[model samples]
Target: MPSSSPSAGFRSGLTASLPITLGYLPIAFSFGVAATRAGLGAAEAVFLSLVMYAGASQFLALALIGTGAPLAVSAVTLIAMNLRHVLYGPALLKQAGADARKKHAWAWAFGLTDEVFGTTLGVLARGQHRFSERFMFGIGLGAYASWVMGTALGAFAGGGALEGFPTLDAALGFMLPALFLALLLSVLRRAQLPLIAVAIGTTALVSWLVSPVAGIFSGMVAGAAIGMIRAPRATKGNTA
Candidate 1:
């Protein structure tokens, strides 16, 4: 059953977020170093993580700014890339069922990055924990804090911080995706395989032909469309 005590829920959520926190540290560190190298100051790099808080999008923003893409274009591209995030709340809440409280959602929802959402959903889907807004808040807070901390350290460390550790630098780039993928596979079902495959293929194709940003957006659209079409069939099969 979902913990009714707010403190208990919060603590549990924080504990569960440990893995995400660890995963984010290196990646955020990488971003910080990259940012400074790209001409941003330590404070500026930290500000990006603090305010924007969009993992991949922040990197993309840095790229856009570095390349002298008009600020308007950069803004639009960032928004388009992260558009899929809009669906995360509804999907998570739906999985949480009617009993899941939303009174604190406005605050907690801000922390719902791809990894955080996947982690919470995995917990609920696996019956490891009942849905609690406080719990969600804890998870989000922990992950966010770690990310910011990592970014600060990296920024201060300067661009050459990882120069001696070439292998580590390369590995950091993969951590975000790898972490999310692990979370996803935890909740994977045979019925969802086709949707995942379609999304991956579309993303890869678009990215290869055009740009990574365009690919991500197209993949999201394709995945959502496929998911909606497949939902009914899955429901019917379950009922039958």
Candidate 2:
């Protein structure tokens, strides 16, 4: 189906978003339980999920809230962690209209969680162009709704629902790591694969000696520097 038709696009979007909805429910429910434990009211927890919309970052920020980590540190770390999306924008720069692009970019930046990015990238990789925005929006909206709903449900049930699902809860918590591993495996290009392995090893070493976050940032910077240094130079006539 051509992606240009609005109806077709909407369907494509909906289809693309299915994986995220499946994955987000339990995780979002866990977040809700955690937020309630942290003293946020039911409504407040839902509100945080709706407004912040970045699951892992929200969890990390909430975890650090009482640890005396300055708000600025949390904010900067979240921003830096999400900066990877800057790489996703150029590829999709063609699909969006001017105003829609701006709105999409802002929404995308705020909502750039693992599942959403993964779903969107998958949709694009399927050779669908015209429907990419609708597909992305569908995924984002589905995940967002699931997050809010899951949190609300969790808050309403309090501890009862959690008590009945211990093993499931543990599995849900591990989903993010599993998703990251899958993503890393998917993007294993020739040059990039070796660099990622080296970066991971270096980051592991630094994390044992220093802060995990700092180690991660340092490893990414080092890998990027190495990639640039080894990049092939363009011939003079190729510029035209």
Candidate 3:
């Protein structure tokens, strides 16, 4: 049985975050290496991890900077890339419901990265443990720390550190997405299949026709629309 005690909750959350921390390390290291190779100093690379903290977007930022894109343009692009994050807090809190206790949400919510949100939601949906802000804190702290540490180490390692490990370099690209997909699958339900399919199709189509960024944004919008349409039907069926 899961304990509701604060200490237990924190410990459990920290334990649960181990997998995510592991996943983040190599990816963060990759980002750090990439950033440095693009001419950023180790401190600057680590600073990006500290403030931005966004996984893919951090890489995107490096690309934009490397290309000498205007600061305004880079800012807008990064914001657009991360707009999905705005919905994460509400989605999470809604799933947690009114009783989940969010007195510290303002702080812990900053750590609700894609992996963190998925892991938290999966745990909550599975009813493995009662919601605890302390748990959220623990999970967030573990992941954040690993990401920062990984960035620091990688930045110091220099860009050529992974040049000899072609296989590992290729594998890192898909690791985060694979982890997120697995987390989503853990909480998958039949009712969500259509939404997923639609989202995938929309994303693929837009990416082929336009740009990857457009594809991602369109897919999110399409999925949200589908989910909204299905909500009433799901609610009605449950009440029937």
Residue clash pairs of candidate 2: 13-135
Q: lDDT scores for all predictions? A: 0.86, 0.64, 0.86
Per-candidate alpha-carbon RMSD to the true structure = 2.6, 5.0, 2.4
- lDDT measured at residue 80 in model 2 versus the true structure, 0 to 100: 69
Q: Write the per-residue lDDT of candidate 1 for residues 1-240, one digit (tens) a residue.
A: 646587988998999899899898998998899999999999999999998899889998888989999988999989988887888898788787765789988899989998898898888877777788889988999999999999999999999999999898888778877887888787777777777788899999999999887887788779767878876866233201
How displaced is residue 73 in candidate 3, in Å?
A: 1.3
lDDT of 1: 0.86
lDDT of 3 at 122: 84
Per-residue alpha-carbon lDDT of candidate 2 for residues 1-240, written as tens digits (9 for 90 to 100): 446665666577667666667677777888888877766778877887887777766677677774668888878987766555555455345323341344455654555566666556544434454434555566667777777888788776664567777888788888767766765555445556546666887788887888676676767666656655564432111111
Cα-lDDT of candidate 3: 0.86
**Tens digit per residue, CA lDDT, model 3, 1-240:** 656898988998898799899899999999889989999999999999999999889999989999999999999999988888887788777777654778899899889998898898888777776678988998999999999999998899999989999999999878888897899788777777777789999999999999888898899789778878887765222201
TM-score of each: 0.91, 0.75, 0.93
The best candidate in terms of TM-score: 3
Compared to the true structure, candidate 2 yields what TM-score? 0.75
